[model samples]
Target: TILSSDAYQRSWKPNETNQQDERNFSRMVVRRLPAEVVADAITQATASNTRVTAMTSSPTDRTIGPDILAKNNKKLTSLNYTLSVFGKPDRTENCDCERSNAPTLLQAVFTRNDPSLISMINGSDRRAKGWIAEVQEWYSGKTKPTNQANGNKRLKQLNDQRKKLLAKAPKKPRNTRDAKATQRYQLTIKKHREAVQVLNRNISKLKGGRSNGNLVKRQITALETDKLINETFLRTVSRMPSANELNMARADINSNQDKIGGVKDLLWTLLNTKEFLVNH
Candidate 1:
């Protein structure tokens, strides 16, 4: 397995004697990730929820459920369309060599200003909620009230339904005749009550209004500058910034009055950096 192989476990630092030996696996030099991998990484890291598969395949490609697949087609359904610019494979050839890994000017341009990437970071048009929004929600101990309210309302409706189901069930000793139905009713009602309790607890935490413990309350307080910088580094580069990098990040953010915007700029800058974009 590659996971247990010497090559895969090799140190990243290049040894002077083997520096020129590309085939010998002397060191783990930086390498560009495959286009599809890059797209998947961005989707995961940013919680962009990008759809990767085409909603509609040609009838020739669809061996089953052709009519259903045809009806479900959508314009913006696949990430492959966007990834082609980065040299995603067309699968015309059987070899993996067909997928391009070489750097391109177009990829650089796309990383900097592509609307698809920007929308992922910022959020979709209908919903202005993405990584930044997620961080804000965490630090503020709140999400859009509308969403929370809707969730609570829906949960209540479901709980009410559960209650009705329970009422329709046979009662007590007589209910024992149908053991499975009585057991299911009792279990479901128990589950509904527990779920309602959890939702109410979460809502309380979101309001920053009297958590059962002080720890949760402290977590919901307004985000600190240093914490935001740390979060950006951890999310984009998968590590904490060095002292110098942290200072530089602070200086850039402190320069602006809009701290959230500063954090946004910092995140964007990090995501564009080679360290975040390539594997070393």
Candidate 2:
């Protein structure tokens, strides 16, 4: 019920009016996100396919077999360095206060000068084609990313998985000694149910439908310059750019000799901005 409230579901926005209405929650303040989120953003910005695997147990838990430990280590290595820079919590504290979201000098330096970030931007480490490549293809009208069929197929798979997880959930402990195991089983099921909720939200967005407006079409020729700029802004900052901002970006691209390079620089600038770096 709490999740259905306006405060919980409200979309965030920057404080554009500069009005001080703190008592009424008139606007949201921009905030530095947690380390895990920042790391995920870097991966998303680079278009890397690597995901942070859910760990079932502590990495240092000696009860786990060597094989499981090695697998966990391999998955951890992918984001460990980036997360460390933003101060990933060690999880030693009992309270959520252990994770710090304070802005730090190190974070700024890393965003500006990290070689790994540049390499990721360049599509190094066998990662999937980066966002720069995708945007370039988009500008050329070579791709149309929407497909309702695919969304429907994925929704079906998620529903099946949810059913299977429910079937496996333990109704009760096998014995008094197994009570802890039953509790853990129910927790895992709950986690999977939450994932279903997320997938449903995404499916709803897809179902909202696409139309051929004046600026862009849903079919092949979605390559209008205005469309590309708006798409970039939406993907990077979760909103469309204002007229002044859009005109400035369009002018920059038009004046630049190297079109691709200009686009790359534009995306890099956005990635480093406070809007992309935090939640508001």
Candidate 3:
């Protein structure tokens, strides 16, 4: 039977052949066995009265020579015969390996603005939601729900009362009694301001204590880095000229507008192309 490597080589034309062959010899079989199944088979073979030998390539070397195979056999007494062959094609393809139909987990995290990717990472399950909530709490450095709510309510009340008092206070003192009233009003404003300041300090402490402040700072830094990377990528892409524009420039077509929608058509074509669709 022709091996998968041979089949692949034969399927492609001479001109289409890659500079370096990329075939997976291990996956040549019609039915690929699981690692556990293969391990079990090896174990059973070893226990049998009949001698058995298995051939495999070295981690760094794709090809195995007869001398190397003999050297390996000297270290093991269980195998009766071993014939390791050289010239097996390496699996690595010469083409862009980064290309993919969808973004990976790390990619999704880096591009945090994508709602679809974020939703996928977060998941729809209750357990996932709980974990997400915990992460959000840590990132935000938020206080206890009840305390946050109460603090905000009190702050609002103080602000509202202060505003009301300020609005009702006399603009100018007309007499000694009026001046005394003005002084009292000023003292009341100062008292309210001090109370507001104290509440704000308490709220700050409650939200981000020393224990979580470092973690919050690190999260902010990571977010800022990602934002910078995203902005740089956007700027680079915006400055790049499309294939249609390049072609027009070559032809000395200086027109800024597309008369036959050539640019649009070229854009659509490029978008659908495998080169553009791939991540690379």
Candidate 4:
């Protein structure tokens, strides 16, 4: 029951509150990360000076964007990032593994963004300078990570809840009737705000909740407001792009513009990049 989405709803009480209790309720939990050790192991492995910094409620807590000067000629061929739930892939044969990985990964990655850089074997090791390298090495197996043993213990017990997807002889009958992809398919991602416009326009006809047109209009208004917020965020992010990014982007487009023409080329590039995409 504690894990249920509605669990806290039932537990709430309208009791008189003290200021101390209020402060206590608002305090954030501090959990140490196993990724710290992973970072250390990577520093040990790569022999490149890098460190991970932790997250704090400050703008200064950002670490290392991709190197702006990183060359197109030297573009990384095998860049990969892998982290599984608390119990990673192959940690355990249990039902709870997949259920637990996402939050764990978020926390681990968050903690990794902050670490104390104690020593510099190579060049000066600024605290966050080496983090990308450390993370890359850890995920790519410079050193063995810590969660595997603990996660494995619960695998069988948790996975017993569901049959393995890859089993050649599935333990139970398959449900094929609901397969949504009836053909070799194409997935079209229409612009998010653009795609939702139809729903917003006709929201009044679809009925739910406690009110009539008034309530539906309020919900649609909220969604549209959210769309505006997302646009604002993306615009702000785009404005902060590195100084030379536009020049580099233009260079890439010069080759293609002759084939597709300039107006469409500019439109496609801006629409497809981080500058225009607001992801949360």
Q: Write the per-residue lDDT of candidate 4 for residues 99-214, one digit (tens) a residue.
A: 33224545344223422222222212433333223423443444333544334434443344223322322132244453444221212223333434544433323322212222
Sliding window of 10 residues with minimal summed lDDT for model 3: 78-87
Best by lDDT: 1
The candidate maximizing TM-score is 1
The C-alpha TM-scores of every prediction are 0.57, 0.49, 0.20, 0.15
TM-score rank order = 1, 2, 3, 4
lDDT of 2: 0.62
156-175 per-residue lDDT for model 2 (tens digits): 77677657766765465567
Superposition error at 7 for model 1 (Å): 10
| Model 1 pairs in collision | none
Query: Taking the tens digit of each residue's C-alpha lDDT, what string does model 3 give over 143-214?
Result: 345555676676566567656655655444456578778897778777766766665666565455324323
Which candidate do you rate higher for lDDT, 1 or 2? Answer: 1
Model 4 off-target regions past 4 Å?
A: 1-129, 138-280
RMSD of 3: 23.6
- Candidates in order: C-alpha RMSD to true structure: 11.6, 20.0, 23.6, 26.7
Q: The CA-based lDDT of model 1 is what? A: 0.64
By lDDT, the candidates rank as: 1, 2, 3, 4
